[model samples]
Structure formats: structure tokens, C-alpha cells
Target: MDIKEKIRNFIESNLIVFEDEAVFTDDDNIFQMGFVNSLFAMKLLGYIEQEFGITVANEDLDIANFSTLNSIVRLIGKHKQEV
Candidate 1:
């Protein structure tokens, strides 16, 4: 699968509530949907760095960049471009 698909699958698999799997969409706000907590955010960061081989900078830790699958994908793209 492509990066976005990979991310979507990863997020879907790691959702806070298992039954809400199908409820997540690319544009959906994960935090607003109560999908992310502090611990989960760090887990997501680790996943992004490990899966994409790109480190997320401190300044880039803004929740906006991680609020949705689409945003995360865009953030990864931005990081990749910078690399």
C-alpha cells in the first residue's frame, strides 16, 4: 500500500475504540473524535519515524499536523521533501 493507505491502516488498527474503526476518515479530526491521548500521540510519532524513516521535529509537533490522516500524510510529505 501507498503511504496514505499505510497510514490509514495503521491508524485504523490502533484506534482507541475498536468498533470505531470504520468511523475514521482521512479528514476526520482524530483528537476531536477522542482517538488520541498523550500516550497515543507519542506512539504515533514513533510509528511515523519508524515507518517512514523520517523524524518529526519538535516544532512540527503541533497537533494540527496530526489531527487527521490527511494532515499526517501531508506532514510526512513535508518532512520527506525537507530531507
Candidate 2:
């Protein structure tokens, strides 16, 4: 329904070991969420790029933009506006 829900659903669907009972809030550290490694991060980036139709550059791969769902949504909004 919303961005948070969308992100949660995406993660849940894609991550096989991700349990539904895990605490996933807007402020939760995605890096500390256990299942997120470099490979998973890249996969997530691919998904974001494909889903939102935006190219995420190497410089944009920092945690500032991809830290959480809220941050990622804001980054996507900014990218969409620029596009």
C-alpha cells in the first residue's frame, strides 16, 4: 500500500531466509538486519533500478540513500523528479 509496506513485501518475497517476525521499521538498520550482505545489496540495487526505472551510480551506492525504506523512497522521488 505505502512505501514501507512495499519495501517490506519486496524484501520478504525476495529473501528466502527472511522471517516475517523480524522487526523491520523505518529506522531499522537494514545492514544489521542479518540477511543483507554485499551480494544481497547489489541484488536490491538491481531491483530498485528495475522497479523505479532509475540508474543508481557507484557514488550513489552509499548508505545515505539506501539506509532505510523512507530514505530510499526519498531518493527515488528525487531521482524521478530529475528524470
Best by TM-score: 1
Using lDDT as the measure, the top candidate is 1
Q: Which residue pairs clash in candidate 2?
A: none
Q: Which segments of model 2 are wrong by more than 4 Å?
A: 16-20
Q: Model 2 lDDT vs. the true structure? A: 0.72
lDDT of each: 0.86, 0.72
- For residues 1-83, write the lDDT of model 1, one tens digit per residue: 89999988777777777664558778999888887666778888999999999999999999899889999999999999999
Report how far off residue 60 is in candidate 1 (Å).
0.3
| Ten residues in sequence with the least summed lDDT for candidate 2 | 14-23
How many Å off is the CA of 36 in candidate 1? 3.1
What is the C-alpha lDDT profile of model 2 across 1-83, one tens digit per residue?
A: 87557776776665545476556777666766764656767787787889888888777888767767788887777777878
